[model samples]
Target: MQGLSAWRDDRCLYCDVDLSLPTGTVMQIRGPNGAGKTTLLKHIAGLSGRRAGQVSWASTDSHDDRDTFTQQMLYLGHLPGVKSALTVAENLQALAACRGINLLTHTISQALNTVHLGGYDDMPCHQLSAGQLRRVALARLFTEPVPLWLLDEPFTAIDQAGVRELEGWLAAHSEQGGVVLLTTHHPLALNCPLQFLDLQPIVEDWH
Candidate 1:
């Protein structure tokens, strides 16, 4: 995005923000609480309304061709976004169906196993712990091989081992020519080059 800005109330949360990420790069948006880190991710994902500046994909206007952008991007918000009544496998299946991809039972099983949710497939999402629910949302990374991943606070509620596994996945994705932009407080130990964008409260000058 070029000169991208967002509003929290009537006042601007961030102003004149500019950012760009190339292929095979992992960028972490870092800041203290309410620093517009998540706002930036949502803006880039076209989830929030734009107040200022532009977002483009490969030099093409992202808003003009949202379908193309959506097809190439995978977004996971901080919230699990899973249905409480749905079983673990059913949730993943619903997610795949939304992306127009039909995953087989074996594929779903394997993805759950990868996220360490192997045996919980038949259990309702509400029956699992918070971390497990997050893992259910995370299983999408294994199923959808999109080029761009926008994750907001993806490391929340997960244990150390899950964090390590996710770190490895991020590195592998970058190495495979995928772009990852995420907001997380957890210090990432990615083997690949990891970039950071720190969002601070915009200071205006009155002369």
Candidate 2:
């Protein structure tokens, strides 16, 4: 995100929350509730049409950026976005398909296992608990090869073990030249160094 700003009805909500992230870096966005954390992420993701801002992927600029960004980016929102009718593996398949990925069945199962859902591959998502659903959503981290990850409230309904497991993944991604941008209220224990983007002052600074 570069020269980033967000507004609602012509009133500034998030002002100048610009960021320059390098590969192998983790950027955490933090603030109190209703501080525009999610909205800021949405703007970066190009989902906030009502907001004014310029968001670029790599050094490429806004025009035609979404196509490239979408290709390399994996976005996990506050909602798990899992389809209850689909089995765990099927949901992962859908996620892989989003990036035009084709993974073998065994590979998909292994990814589920990595997320601590070993035997739940063929089980319908509705049969799983809230945390399980979140895990299913997280399984994409393994199946997708996206280099940019935008996660909103990723820790919601996730357990401590899952949290640490995710931190490990984040570290690995950073080490492997991936960029992670996320919003969370919980403090992260990441092996990679993290940069915090506090939205509190950005919110208060808006005029």
RMSD of each: 1.7, 2.3
Alpha-carbon TM-score of each model against the true structure: 0.94, 0.91
Per-residue lDDT of candidate 1, residues 1-207 (tens digit): 799899876657788888888999899988888788888888888887647778888888787898888888999999999999999998989988998989898998889899998888789988999999999999999887799999998999999998999999999999999999999878889999999998887655657
Which residue pairs show backbone clashes in model 1?
Answer: none
Largest TM-score belongs to which candidate? 1
Error in Å for residue 21 of model 2: 0.4
Residue by residue across 1-207, what tens digits does model 2's lDDT show? Answer: 656777766566677667888888899988887678888877877787567656777677655666777787888899999999999988988878777788789888888789889988889999999999998888888888788889999999998888898889998999999999999888899888999888763334446
lDDT, candidate 2, at 204 = 42
Relative to the true structure, candidate 2 reaches a TM of: 0.91
